[model samples]
Target: MRRDDPIPLVVDLDGTLLRSDLLLESALAYTRAQPLRLLAPLAWLAGGKAHLKQRLAQAAEIDVTTLPYDQRVLDLIGRERAAGRRIVLATASHQLYAERIAAHLQLFDEVLATENGVNLSAERKRDRLLQQYGQRGYDYAGNSNDDLPVWAAARHAYVVSAGGRLQRRAAALGNVAAVMAPVAPLQQLRTMLRAMRVHQWVKNVLIFLPLLAAHAANQPTRVLAGVLAFICFSLCASSVYLLNDLLDLPDDRRHKSKRKRPFAAGQLSLGIGMALAPLLLLAAFGLALWLLPWRFSAVLLAYYAITLGYSLYLKRLMALDAITLAALYTLRLIAGAAAFAVPLTFWLLAFSMFIFLSLALVKRYAELREARRRGETAQASGRGYFPGDLEMISSLGAASGYLSVLVLALYTQDRATVALYSRPQLIWLACPLLLFWVTRTWMLTHRGQMHDDPVVFALKDRASLLVGLLFALIFWGAS
Candidate 1:
């Protein structure tokens, strides 16, 4: 009963009242204030939008309270409420942040943010608003061009100062109105990069594991197909990651370290993810279809569906969680075989599963270990594995590595073996090195020193690095 129009006042936080420009300002201030080691990465991220929204969300949560909110704007909210209107604070910022801002204003009856845990970005904000207010008629106020879609989506549009390019283009639209916020290009760029999360693309390299061991060494066509497969897979994976992050933004903001993720941090917006996700998917499958045809296109589609399920339902399950993750990795190998039209052997299938299962278990152990060490409440996402249980997982990981070695050795000697290893004699050298690598890696993992990702760790750890080199050299020299 605070807003004058009882028509339901839909007010956006970032641009309409709290100067939206403050986000970029905060980002710049943060970069300059921090040590170069930290600031440099953020600034570099700014050059691209890979992690922009996340960084901004984080900055907002950390510094929004400290920054001086406009007294006039605060007074307007207070006075507007006193006028007996149905006031509401609408924003694409994290719900936590939005709620805090709403509470501080105390003029609104209800606050509409992203999912209570999900960071509300532009599109999400629009979606929620529409779900409540309807698409044909509702007054919408926002700061950036990203807000235009949502505004144009409304019955009437109120543009804040930060809406430069968007306002110019949308001014002619019947419902558009105008307001003020500062605008800076470089600062926005920095925020955008942090939101995109480019570093995560490295995970896509897993798609190449099958090629590393298979017989594609001499064939350029197969090699090219493999690369294309990984690239498409990476794009799809990242798209799903973005969707997952968008969906989990709320919980992530609650978590200690995960809060630093782009969406949770406020640098990215839900609208951006919604807008970008389809484009990314199209590109992923477009390449999948162009390079590999229907068979592979189906695998890529399946990967997407499986991962989307993981994001929504499977990830929270305990043991099943790791199994799904391991299967997903195995699928990458399967996809590679299909892409190259190469024959897959029993050893390759079994080896990939066993290795990934152990690796997934190790990831669970690391997560649980972190939780236990911190004395925090942690639940296994759906993997049937617990954060506090590492001993069994460690043993299992060790067994998996050794078993992989055993399988590969037997595969070399198996009557059905098509490889030229000659009675498992040459392949035997790979055994101890694998044992050394797996054991050492697990030893470090148990000690709580191994990085969260085993694949990434293999790239960095000196011993595993050496093991990988030895495996490649031995395999090639024998050939």
Candidate 2:
């Protein structure tokens, strides 16, 4: 065990050299490509994990370049290579992915991975290494308890972990050489909350629109129902957001800002996302069924169903994506009406559809602009949009927004308006306000200043908030 010993430095792949798992990555990629075959993984798993990995490796096309590699591991390999030591990559990941990753890094002199129905993990990995290098003949670098057997057999152990617990355990083996700690937990609770997209819960405010339109806000029971419905809808939406992030991992990794997201950046494990999504969905439905009316529960179910569809398929279909987004927004209003036991007015529905549709288009337009800025000439990744379609989207969005304003203007002259307002003419002021806000929104989108979500942007924009306040005041004066 001299300093110049020629013992090979063997490194583990998943959780050692990389911060993420290839098995989960390949499975998600396969699922995203063929969403209809989601059950295929279960059937494949019946053959065992090795068989599953082989099948997924053949089915999914993973971009190895975009993977989250551990820089500490890379630096270790670099220093070892400079010292004239042989470097080997030994992983339990499928051979296809392991080889691809090895080739991408171009540092490994040899690779040993799961192949031929033999999963190279734990005891199997130890046996394979003993066969190739003999007992206590090589230095091993690994993470997780699964590597304990291999570490026991190696001459020295290099523990790669975020915390000291694993390092302490590895030290018990009495051959611990070095510990390479990656960026530790940055408050995992905060990361999980971010993955849940709690900020986007502001969209659930739409659930109170029905109570406001029906002038039932003064009714304590109806107001309470609205609050409950908001909670249920927000939970459901957060579930969908998690699922969407899981599915959009590859695309998000290529985006500038999206790459920093918890899942895409490998700050959170995909297993956690997979488990939490359904739990949140169940909680949403449980709350709706137990506390809210059955009608509200039904609306919530429909909302979840539509969102699932959008996440799986509709979001990639050209105009349908925007239309579905608008429908989702309008469903919030319907949920509010159901919670308050109030009928949705035709005027309100029409106005919401047009306005939300315009906002949805703004979202798409902003994405396309971002792609153009990134110099991507092809279709927007994970979307059915081209940068060339920006002009058409702008036109359609502006027209839809103006149409909403027109709907508002016509509503002011309706018999319903005369009954609801003491001075109906004051409602006319809202039209110009709506028109101004919509025009400014599109203008910002065209100038590439719009956030990826127009609704979220509106919540933060100063002019948008001012317009909203003035618009609310006009409605109050009219009443």
lDDT for model 1: 0.67
Q: Cα-based RMSD of the predictions, in order?
A: 12.8, 1.6
Off by over 4 Å in 1: 1-11, 14-163, 166-214, 377-386, 416-419, 422-424
Candidate 2 TM-score, C-alpha based: 0.96
lDDT of 2 by residue, 1-479 (tens): 34487799999999889888999999889988998898999999999999999999999999999998888889999998988889999999999999999899999999999999999999999999999999998999999889999999999999986467777788999999998865556677789999999999999999999888887789998888888888999999999999999988888999888999999988887898999999999999999999998999999889989988998889999999999999999999999999999989999999999999999999889889888887788998888999989999999999999999999999989998799889999999998889899999998888889865888888898899999999899989877
Q: All candidates' TM-scores? A: 0.66, 0.96
lDDT of 1 by residue, 66-119 (tens): 333545456655655677756678765555566666676567778876542444
**Candidate 2 at 141: error in angstroms?**
1.9
Off by over 4 Å in 2: 1-3, 162-165, 182-186
